[model samples]
Target: MEDESGIFARESAYLERYVQLGIASGRVISVSFPAAPEDDAEPDHPLLERVVAYLEGERDDFEDVTVALTVPTAHRTVLEATRAIPYGEQVSVERLARTAGLDADSDDDRNVVRDALASNPAPLLIPDHRVRDGPSAAPPEVEQRLRSLEGL
Candidate 1:
């Protein structure tokens, strides 16, 4: 877990929405602060709570949460396989491609995995940091931090 005093979130009305996570320094990717909290009793704020909990060191798999991913078919396949990566575990891009039903030994297949992760719409939800042997949605430092947090 990391210190969450700087934590912030932008919630969505839809139950499942894409989120970009940057855990290092607690900088919420593409987030904005209102300078003052709103008083609205929005019922769809569970994502905020779950993200806060995850930052606070909870071992949340996040499988319970859904996301609306709109990507190319190849990217979608790779991202969905990435999403199935269990907490504290990792796999190579070739392996991930294989899991996604692509030929594991094909360079093109592996590149697709890399490109898909680079464009991942839901970082934390997809856990792209777990892709050990290729490009990740997380920045280098952020990826290291996330892996450390997962006890890898």
Candidate 2:
């Protein structure tokens, strides 16, 4: 298992539009597009620069980003499977469950996967958006841009 820390720091940027990065315990906790700026706004940092580069398709810098999330044990499998999804690709919940060694056919197990994805704390870093049935925390345009970058 990887130590879920020191991967990225919380940073904000106006890449394409205003976005917020939430990091803690040395790992990214969330990525969101805020409608307004918060009071403690800081200037763009290296992490944001890397994220911008990634979104622009200039580089795959975000691939190295790590995230820290504290969900129930059952959700861990779902998150782990989500993390393994390659950039520019999508997979169904059943496929994800199977990849995570869970019983894909079980309604209860599938629900766990779906719920975990819906509640994903880290979006871009863990990339729950890559899951076909997962909720996307990022703006639809941003998600579309990412997919376009991959020619998906």
Candidate 3:
């Protein structure tokens, strides 16, 4: 497990650390940091190593890891665009909507983007933190730490 230092070290209402891997694809789906730590958590998983490397700032990108997400059809484009955002980069909701081929000027599209990010099932894997105007599903401090890791 990665050291819970800096922003991660602090206790938050949502700080639950656990790894969820896809059964069929054998890929990491979500790595949550909830308030209370779990006892007897699984310690050895290949994907956990990668996730640790990421949180510890030892890795720059998660492109090699496949993520499992069940986004609604309306929100799929926004999530896909968010997933495409590179490590350390940030984009506004309008820009993200444009990247997803949605109308950048349409409030509906921007709201869709925001809603998608706010409800992201796979937080770190999809990197909704990279979206500037969109609401983050992860804790704000965690998001800031991730941005700092990327030097964004």
Candidate 4:
């Protein structure tokens, strides 16, 4: 795992990716990065493969993956808009509010988008990294990794 410079590089293996994705009713519910290593075998899910590939620097929109919104109805609307953010692109929370048909000028409207991203259950699938401002979808390190992978 050491680079030519002799510094250890972060691994992106399927298991080492260590992104915990939760699902129910055949839909993704949550995605999180834990400090501990995964214990059990990798779950038998096609999206897991795609996610691994994405972590390895592949470009995947993940738009085809279905996710169940755990947020409120209005917040779900913001998440719905979040899903439209293209791969390798970044948008501010205010722009996301406007995309969700919320008044960008209203702090309340922007807050809704912020809150939705903050509580985003399915981070990678929802591509919360594509959204800037307010809360982040993944941890600071993971978020930077994702951005680097996307060349953002």
> lDDT for each of the candidates?
0.67, 0.68, 0.68, 0.74
Candidate number achieving the greatest TM-score relative to the actual structure: 4
With a 3 Å backbone cut-off (N, CA, C), the pairs that clash in candidate 3 are 14-34, 15-33, 15-34, 15-35, 16-33, 16-34
Candidate 3 — worst ten consecutive residues by lDDT sum?
Answer: 1-10
Please give the ranking of all candidate structures by lDDT, highest first, separated by commas: 4, 2, 3, 1
Pairing residues by index, what is the TM-score of model 2?
0.79
lDDT of 2: 0.68
Q: Residue 97 deviation, candidate 1, in Å? A: 0.7
After aligning candidate 3 to the native by TM-score, how far in Å is the CA of 38 from where it should be?
A: 4.4
Candidate 1 versus truth, CA RMSD in Å, comes to 9.6
Query: Which of the two, 1 or 4, has more lDDT?
Result: 4
Model 3 ranges off by over 4 Å: 1-29, 38-40
lDDT of 2 by residue, 20-84 (tens): 66656546777676655456655455667767666656646266666667889878788888888
Off by over 4 Å in 4: 1-17, 37-44
Give lDDT for model 1: 0.67
lDDT of 2 at 90: 91
Model 1 off-target regions past 4 Å? 1-44
TM-score of each: 0.71, 0.79, 0.78, 0.84
